[model samples]
Target: MSEPAVTQHPYYHPQPGTAWEHVDTAGSLLAGPTPLVTLANWQEEPHHVWSFQHMRELMPSQVIDGTDEPRPLPEAPSDLSALEVPVAWAPTVEELLDRTQTDAFLVLHRGAIIDERYVGRMGRRRRHLVMSVTKSIVACVAASLAGDRLLDPDAPVEAYVPELARCGYAGARVRTVLDMRSGVTFRETYLDPDSEVRVMERSMGWAPRNHGDPLGMYPYILTTTAGRPHDGVFDYRSIETDALGWIVERAAGRRMSELISERVWKPIGAFHDAEITADPLGVAIHDGGLSATLRDLGRFGLMLHDHGDVAGRQVLPHWWISDAAAPPVDVREAFAASVNEPVLPGGWYRNQFWFVPGDNGPILLCLGIHGQMVFVEWSTGLVGVKLSTWPLPQDGDKLVATINAFRAIGRTLAREGG
Candidate 1:
């Protein structure tokens, strides 16, 4: 099928504004020509990246899923000097630390906290935007409903969201949407004025500079026209996650934010409350817009590494974990081919999480735009969280190298402890 047509817009450049109110060193640290960050076929936008630590107030979100009781955290390691992994590609972490702007980093192994670090105005108390990592969290909520028979992956999506009957989602099955195989006619160009993604931004109030008529995201999503036949091929569409979120709301009879808090956050004993940004209409941006402290994100990764068991109680169904970690049936190879970009090779997308199929055992990762990650290697019992506000977007190579180095370091630690 042909790709959607691109739209042209007047190129924009960032103008110095009132310095970010939250960051103390905003003027001294963030001052400069905001670099243009481009992704895939997307055009570059003149953007001044904001530090993760100061993103909480910029976007608003509701707490959807969490547990009431705080899950007990394993003791933190006293020293992390023994863990070392040489970087095979890109600069080493130490070198990157010197050159790359970073916010927070945390590592866990065997359910124990091993290493934690913060940099450049980042602290344990601050919340950072997780961007697309929100997709994985939303996927978990959908999986929970499916586990309870509230949702059927094989069924048509219109069963839950009939409003999408006319858009690109028409005739698509829930599984296809979950796998991102929908035949939706949408463009993801970030800088294009006419792209549907840009339209989504305008609708969601993210494109503040655009004076065009308001095009709310949910309404635009419902209007997406079907392009290719359903299940014809795998296409990475963020709108699919949004659609899933809508379905989740329909089946659970609650908002995505609240559902996440009840089912995953509170039960797993999240260290802090996480928030998801909503549209002008108060609909949560499930594909992105999630924010939380680094420790809380690390704890969630630990829960996945433990096979959905927290404190010896099954918070999420074990089968749900297994299913979520497994690769998609039709799109594994296509997804894997993009791993060299920085994250993984031969990786699979399942339930919105990235799965690496290898002899080393499957590694499940939650990824976000602008370099947010929660990597969980089940075989080695390692979990790593990285949050960053890189000057530009679309640097998968750096992310991949960092994760590989992390895996290497994790192995060394396991051997020493063994």
Candidate 2:
């Protein structure tokens, strides 16, 4: 397992019968400056635990500025430590953090923060990479643009990015890519280093350097091949978000950082500036390269909770939020026939958010690799964001456990006066 096993990565596999309570990462760290943590090995366990928070040191990033006059968090702080969460081993709330490799966790009720904690090396002010959670934010912006008639989802990708006419995205619609229903033959298996997705990662500077095939973000998208028909199957391809990012740039005539800062962070009153990694050609890696403070993420969640209103201002369109949260019947049905995962049981993936319907209502979630997540229960106005650095890309049991923990948190907050 030390030599990059095909199915297993190094460090922190939970020992048998203990869940993740007994997992240790002391043996896997390359801590000193002698062994620098480059982008190539940055996603590994111990390295990722640090690199995820500090991507600016390895790659060029653009700032998503926030307002100087920050919107104060509603005064409703509670002891997250006492809020015990259920787990297979014990009822300790810490178990959820330890098992999931959580660096920061925040829970909000009715737009007021109920509980917040920073674990491991996480500090109050430091920004942590939200990974694919960035996709949801990007989706919100894209939907907002479509609402304003600045962009058309039904239009072909080539309409905005005419350069894609010869690429696999020639026939793909903006909405299809947003919903991840594009019939582009791009595999996203993170476990295999040689996979097509990894190739994309290498091009984006997330993986090891290969001087031979150093494709930029645009060129990589152009290399994609046509696959099955666009059948609304809810296929998840990270590159689709990048394509959407480009489409948005073309439609809005502005960079992603500028749009997000102007639209989201400033209006939401984020205290700290967010950042997103960019390729060498200055293309923002919108798929999974956003980093932001935990409080700002909660603020963004509050905006969604209130149907896109932030600090008395409508930062996003209400119709867009509701519609994206509630995907069409055909799209929802497609999810039933698509890939099955523990956390995504019969849920719809529309415009970068996952719709997991419950009896009370639907719980929209945005999950990223290595356990970054934003879980929102719109019915109860409960939102939870967890940033972590789990060693592996996917873990079925961990995914189940994460959703269960979110449910437990929601239920607990509902009964008490949080």
Candidate 3:
């Protein structure tokens, strides 16, 4: 097999004289008087430098409000600029930011902020796209419901969303959907504009669409059909999360925006409100499309690190968080034999969260396209978040390096008493 990406050359940037050289990320101006951000493709190139953080401006969305009395994170910001993280073949932490196109990143140890920084016009107040990290956040809410017997993991999807009675998800259990073993025809290809991902994006108003197209999240979801049998094998399906989101809403008799605000953001003490992109029909895109400030994202990670507790309150159920952190045994084996196998050696997906098994306790992760990550290392009580706008949608090398960087940071924190 070819060398693992984490063990490859460190610098993955384009050549010195390429057109992307010295591109302006502030106004997203590519050339003189020519802004790259257009309705046709605001998510493309230099445009995303702005769009990634200002998604609420480009699309219809609903606010997931935060609390007025936002609980404060203890700050002891250490200058990690010189902290030499020992990734297999990665650059220094400071250099990695530039090499990876990170917009903002934070490192927390034991619920206190140790290091945080911003680049490319990103700051503490602005909410940046956490992309599919939204899936994990929504998953936590779903698990909360399950903890309270409001939803049953073994219950069929049809039990929660009876409208799906005729769909592929009809007989699929909520547990199967959570584990991504619900065999579906959906394929997420970000490079192909004609792909299903783009179809969903257009339906959600991320890209331009025909004036009278079938324009709703539900319509797009109902169109999907199963391709193969689900035999306890893991498949990374983005639409599965959307289906689970529907189930959660039906079970709670509330919209995702309301439930997430009441259960997650408000109780967790997020500093600012988060937003989710919604279809023109006002249905929130629960699979992806969450945007929040970096620090707030870190706060969620810290909570997960503590197994869903903050201060003395059980913001999320400890048992539920523990269950998510440790998936079914068969599912874990299936995950190791699947796509995410390469991402994390022995990783499993449960309720949209990633559980990476190791000698240390599981590393709970929330990963997103274009390099958004919330890594909660329970073994060391460390948490980290990195939000980026990579030029390409998928880069295996960058992802491997990111995992390594987090590991290095975790090791340093554990050893030096962060």
Please report the candidate that would top TM-score against the real structure: 2
lDDT of 3 by residue, 224-286 (tens): 777777546788878888888999999999999999998888878998999998888888889
lDDT of 2: 0.79
Residue 398 C-alpha lDDT in model 2: 74
Model 3 misses residue 63 by how many Å?
A: 0.8
Clashes of each: 30, 0, 0
Model 2 Cα displacement at 311 (Å)?
2.7
Error of 2 at 251 (Å): 0.7
Give TM per candidate. 0.83, 0.90, 0.89
| Residue range with the least summed lDDT across 10 consecutive positions in model 2 | 5-14
Instruction: Give the backbone clash total of model 2.
Output: 0
- Model 1 Cα shift for residue 103 (angstroms): 0.7
